[model samples]
Target: MAKMQRNTVLVVLSFFAIYFIWGSTYLWNKIAVTELPAFMLAGIRFVIAGSLIFIISKILGFSLKITKQQFKNTILAGFLFLTFGNGVVVWALKFVDSGFAALEVSAQPLVVLLMMRVFQGKKIQPMSIVGVILGITGIFLLVGQKEIIAQDGAILGMVLIFVCMLSWSYGSLFVGNADLPKNFFVNTGYQMLTSGISLLIISTLFGEQWISPIDWSIPVITSMLLLIIFGSIVTFTAFNYLLRIVSPEKVATSSYVNPIIAMILGWYFLNEDITAQSAIASVVLLTGVYFINTKKSLTIFSRFSGKRIPKDPVG
Candidate 1:
């Protein structure tokens, strides 16, 4: 009974961490990059966070050694998720609002479904097809707002965020299947370290300006620290734990709520504007997400290739 209670409490706490902490990361990233170069900022953040976690994990008696295949998978996953997925989105946020970027990334489940179907030959559920269509339509409506359409470079930025979403979905799928270190913290630390180094190399190759003696203003420093400690360590650890205990589809439900948290934070803290189209689109997109993640609701069409594909309610 005590174990059950403890499990329930941990689950609830992990949900809170992933929902609120990951949601707030968008705003923090926006603030941090306002004064820092994107790649350098991200590189430093991850490296420091990874190093700290590595040391803490070691102190906690977690083994740092892993198989060669594990190392390779971790490096590939890191580059895909952190370097291209997160680093590019941080860069793109210079031209895009934090809330909008969150909305764009909220389509990750749809992208993941496509990746599984195309690469792994997984069968697509009938409702998943409808969800994808609705998701695309929601994106069109969301991006049609005057605020986004009028901004310079908004189109390119939005495209980059979408690319980021694709990379993240692929990475998430890969990591979900790959065998890694038994220790989750150890695996995450290596991922961060590898991606951080890769990002720094890319920054150097691209001739990104390096600011010496970074201006440690309260906001910038606070944002960086928050990202390192809460965003990287606590929230990510919680997310990984959730993935262990729940189905990936259920774990992804956090994406539906993240945009709402991000939009609210962006509005309250950064004074970012939200239009009617975006508001409507949020509802539509989350509805689509619900459809994609939920299983076996209402069957409409199922007799293709002698298989019965379940159609679920839009709820």
Candidate 2:
């Protein structure tokens, strides 16, 4: 009974962590990217976080071993989800508001649905078809705003963010069946490490100037630390834990909540403008996500496939 009660407390706290911490990451990334090159900033953040996870796993007596195929799979997942999916979004933050980026990325479930149809030939359920329609309407409302599209590079940023969405959606499908490390923590660590290394290499190839920690302003430093500790490590750990303890549908609620938190934080802290059109789009888009999530037929991955479908990781 005591163990059950303790588990309940942990579940509540974990939900809070994923909901709040993951949502705030957009603001943190925006703050950090203002002064640092995007690739270098992301590379350093993930590398340090991944290394810390490795150290902690060792201290907790978790083995870090994995087969070569798992290693290769981790690399592929990392590049798709983090190196390109997340890294490119960070770069786009320079051109778009943090809240805007969050709102745009919230359309991920829609993209995943379309991808499944195209690649897996999965039949789109009737309810999900409605979601796809609403999602498209919301995206059009959000991106078609003249005030937003009129800004220099705004269109480019939106385009790149869409591409990132594709990468992430595809990664979700791939990881569903891929043979990864059995330990979720270790699997995440490996993905981070591999992706971090790839990002640094890309940073070098792109000639992004690296800034020393000593030269970073207090805000940038604080944002980076927050991103590493809370956004990446703590929230990811909670996310995996919640997946084990609850229905993935419940765990997936973060999708509905994160953009709301992000938009509020971005508005309060960064003074980002949120127009009426954006507010309506948020309603429409999130409603679409709600429909998709609630209908079992529209679940991210079909369970009938006899493959393990992991919940989508926090952005």
lDDT of each prediction vs. the true structure?
0.78, 0.85
lDDT of 2 by residue, 30-61 (tens): 99999999999989988998999999999999
Model 1 earns a TM-score of 0.89
Report each candidate's C-alpha RMSD, comma-separated, in the order given. 6.0, 2.6
Candidate 1 segments whose C-alpha is farther than 4 A from its true place? 1-5, 246-250, 296-315
Clashing residue pairs, candidate 1?
298-311
Whole-model lDDT for model 1 versus the true structure? 0.78
What TM-score against the true fold does each predicted structure earn?
0.89, 0.95
**Global CA lDDT computed for model 2:** 0.85
